[model samples]
Target: MAKDKTGRLHVTVKTGGKRKLSSKLWLERQLNDPYVARAKREGFRSRAAFKLMEIDDKYRLLKPGLSVVDLGAAPGGWSQIAAKRVQAVEGKGKVVAVDLLEMPEIAGVTFAQLDFLADDAPEKLVAMLGGRADVVMSDMAANTTGHRKTDQLRIIGLVEAAALFATEVLNPGGTFLAKVFQSGADAELLAQLKRDFAAVKHVKPASSRQDSSERYVLATGFRGGALR
Candidate 1:
């Protein structure tokens, strides 16, 4: 370990190992990331818990007695936080989480191994909540292909699907929040959101990586009609 320009001891990975350079870099970043350590210490599933925590702190989106749907909720980071905020443990509220991968159960979270993009997902989620939801949030990200434009479009497509699902299942005055990246291609999504919601804006939580272009689109006050 040697002190870098920031005067913090930086652990350098040996370059000549059998590991690929990309793998080595990723391991190094994971090792150095404070949030990753913090998450382990705090018993949260992943570092992504803080991103949702920060966003909820500012927006007051999750509330007691509110029903929430979490899309792409593998490992249950956001679902954990949402379950607590909505008081799901006491049965005052509800949190329904779904992902393409199996998630170990979290307290107060009803989990399903299913893809959010499926045609039946909306109806399934509404049934889980026993009705409409007060909030729908997605942190789904497509696998990165190292091609910037292609990767951006993939994530945008996920956000679009989540947004449309929210429009279908959210109660009047409900909230929709989804992860998106910085790009001009999101303008059309924003336009659709503005038509369906009273307020819409982009949110970059402090917990997000500074070098990353990742941001979230938060839409509030659902007008209730799912605009086609």
Candidate 2:
């Protein structure tokens, strides 16, 4: 490891033994990533916590007394920030985290290991939240195949599902945040959101890697068109 012009330590991971070149490069990037190190020091589950932190700091979307739902919230980084901002552990708010995989417990977060696409998911989440959610956020991404178009379609499908779930579970004037790629939310999706929300925008936080195309689609001020 050596310090670069940015004064950050740069690491080199040589492809040793059976390690592929791609794997070596990935390891090297992880070793040199500042957010990864910061997450460890700050006790956050993943570096993704900083993305939500940065977005929330600017938007003030999370607040005390708000009810929140985290879709596909494994590893619980976003949930941690939501809990703190919403004061969930203090009983001033509620946060429900749902994922297909089991997540270790997080303070002030209720974990549900279930697919959000299931028929009863929206209702179940609203019940867990003790009322409609003031915010529904998702950091979920579909596992990518080598095929770019297929992967993009999968991601869009997931985000669309999350948005629909949010509409069903969120309170009037609520917010929705979801991770998206460089192509951004599809035009059709954006049009629907424009009708449902007072504001909709695509945002990339400083914590999100510039090299990565990942960004977030934020929609606020829900008009509440839930069917039962």
The number of the candidate with the highest TM-score is: 2
Model 1 poorest 10 in a row by lDDT: 179-188
**Consecutive 10-residue window with the lowest summed lDDT within model 2:** 219-228
- Tell me the tens digit of each residue's lDDT in model 1 across 161-220: 888889889999999999888752278899999999999988999999888788888999
- Candidate 1 ranges with C-alpha deviation above 4 Å: 4-7, 225-228
Q: How much lDDT does each candidate structure score?
A: 0.89, 0.92
Cα lDDT tens digits for candidate 2, 121-199? 9888887877789999999999999798999999999899999988989889999999999789999999998988999
The TM-score values for the models, in the order shown, are 0.94, 0.97
Q: In lDDT terms, how accurate is model 1?
A: 0.89
Model 2 scores a C-alpha lDDT of 0.92
Candidate 2: list runs displaced more than 4 Å.
none
